[model samples]
Target chain A: MTFTLFDNEERMAGRAEAALRDLDFGSDEARAAYSELLDAYRKSLREQRRMMRLGDRLQEQLSTVNQELVRRRAEAERALQQLRDAQDSLIQAEKLASLGGLVAGIAHEINTPIGITVTAASILADQVAGLRRQFQAGTLARSDFEEFMTTADEASRLVLSNANRAVMLIQSFKQVAVDQTTADRRVFELKPYLSEVLTSLSPRLRRAGHRVVVECDEGLEVDGYPGALFQVLTNLVMNALQHAFEAGKTGTIRIRARLFDADTVELRFTDDGNGIAAADQGRIFDPFFTTKRGAGGSGLGLHIVFNLIVGTLNGSIAVQSQPGEGTTFIIGFPRVAPARPVAV
Target chain B: MNIHDISRAPTDRSPEIQFDPDACSLSISGASFPEDGAAFYGPVLSTLDEILKALDQRCVTVRIALNYFNSSSAKALMNLFLMLDDAAQAGNQVIVNWFHAADDDTMKEFGEEFAEDVRFVRFNVIPTAVTS
Candidate 1:
């Protein structure tokens, strides 16, 4: 085992042999020990590299799972937030609707008295002017005085009635405004509810220069708490009149309701004004979502309307609109009127 | 905002909630499951109470005709039903008819639940529709 390969390349071979001898491979035992040490060193180096690679892969997988978890959690939170926001908007819309109904009814109670008072006041003023003329012409007498007194009294009564009517409407409005039934339920009528709602919204609509034309099927009836519907309609109509038509411009709002198929009552409101945009259609019903930002638009109007129709009314409402065209809202109320209508 | 309450009519999604006063008659129909069920149905219950208290006869006919309502609204409906039932127990003939679709077993079950809470108020579950 001590042979040297220095016959051909004697110089290079002699250097290798010397180097190998310097490694101190003396006997079989010493050689085996050196080889064992070298093999252990190489194995440890390979193991460390393999461990590092495995650790890198494990960390990458953990990071991916964490990212997925964050994404899913964010999605869940978004959904929950949306639900909460929608619920809140729904409550607001229902409250507005109820108040509208009450106001409309109260307004009906006031109209007659106000109308009569206005007429009486006008007539009395005319009579007073006539009396003053007669007196100025030196033709006034005791009979004339008595007539004037009678006229004055009548005028005063008319004034009082008119004032009372105004007071009632105001009171009704106040009641509606301050109503805190974040939760309320009661049974009310259709006609009076609608009437009150319209009356409540009179000023708002009038201020917007929009006119409402109602065509209710005379005998059409259903059982629903009208306040929510009133709010829903008020918001929708006012939205069309005020926002869609632009302030100071006049538009026609048509409200038509009829019993359909004996099992559903359909109420359709169409406005001849600028309609909603196509892009805004899907998001119109989202809470706090609006195209009109910073114009005092809370973006809850349509959201409320949606809640009122779907939540309160337990009905379906759909919107059709085109920019620069007109918007139409169709509401389907399931069942109104008797299966057997009484022969009126 | 006074409570806006109505008894549904008899139908697939309706109840005949009626307030028949000597002065006027009030009826409610359609579905009322306000997102804020409590807010929507709250004033209605109170207003109804006021109206019923002021009426000549405590006996008012209420109909509820709702096609769909959420769980929160179901509570409100139950509250209304209980109120009517109480009025009936107090010597008033309060008739409550729970309406549903014949094919709608869920609604029928709902009607039955509402019917269980009555002593004197006549509770009737009527499925007027042939199919839900």
Candidate 2:
């Protein structure tokens, strides 16, 4: 038997015509059968055509919706990236502002020793001029000359000591200032480096009547980013001075460092001042969270500290405090810091 | 009856077709939305017609499991069922199983609608836990 394929309505119609021709039209039964078959085929064809139109429309709608979703996803991703970039720049600005504050404090601190040295040198110059006059008049007694010698000796000694003090102040200030500005990794004795950071912050500490005591092994060395460490210490000390002690009240901040393990070192910074409230402890490290919102608190200090430790140094920090008792920040990091990703 | 088996592999836009001569079973599964539905289903339909003509009181089983089908494929499916219905009317046992995912109400409705049109074939609309 030959198969005639019915691939479309025209082919089906042609096949129906052929079947009608093969049938005996004189027989009523044959006519009725052909009529029934034609009716069913026409009904099915109508329904199929209706469904075809509906399917075409549905496909068009689906494609349009899919395109819209793709465009919206791209737009949302771009917006998120922009928000992250803005956040990074804000963090950088906050860090620079804190460094600027330290610079001002150190400048004021160096003024005292430098001023004393200048005053002593002026006194010595006046004494030498008087001695020259006395010797030229031919009326200088041995007793006067000996007394002048003693005064000259004391004045010279005062100038030498005060100048040396000024030099020492500048040296420490220079070290801390450079470290804070340039984020370079190096090996340094932890005790002396902490001392240098504290020295740079000495003027603010003295003004607030706060004393910082550092305790660490004399030979305890750390290979890490000193600039990040400087930022962390500066932020913690400033945070304490700002929120801890009341005006004109004296306080002490102690920083103790020890080896937690062969590979890790821990530093505990504790201040004997007002402690954080229990409710505020959880949000203290969050950006723009502060009890002193309008009272000269940018609130980014602790947030910056947290980011530097966790992100840059790959370290961990935790705070413990009780109201009216004190607050202690426990920081732990590797002895040799992990390699940081190169900046893009 | 020396009827050859028909087998068609599934594409991204079309369903798989399998016909077993020994078991007297035909199964079509997967999504069917071919660009040229008539061209795709024409050969299968001709082969089914030949198999039905060669049968002598043989029980033929047809199973369809579709996730989606365009209108052209739907038309082709209607023709296939009609042929099965004709065979059942001529004293042959024909069983048609329409399987749909339990969650797909549209496919279930399509099965019911198709069953209403066919009179002789034993049409069973089955709800399956998994969709093919």
lDDT of 2 by residue, B22-59 (tens): 88899999988776776787777877887787787989
**Which candidate number would show the highest DockQ if scored against the true structure?**
2
Looking at model 1, residue A162 earns an lDDT score of 81
Model 1, A224-261: lDDT tens digits are: 54555656776787578546786667888888887777
Instruction: Supply the global lDDT for candidate 1.
Output: 0.66
lDDT of 1 by residue, B23-102 (tens): 33455566643434445556556677666555454556655556666555565666667667667666766776677767
Query: What TM-score would chain B receive for each of the candidates shown?
Result: 0.76, 0.93
lDDT of 2 at A342: 30
Q: What is the Cα root-mean-square deviation between model 1 and the actual structure?
A: 33.0
Q: Which ten residues in a row have the lowest lDDT in candidate 2 chain A?
A: A1-10
User: What local lDDT does model 1 show for residue A251?
Assistant: 84
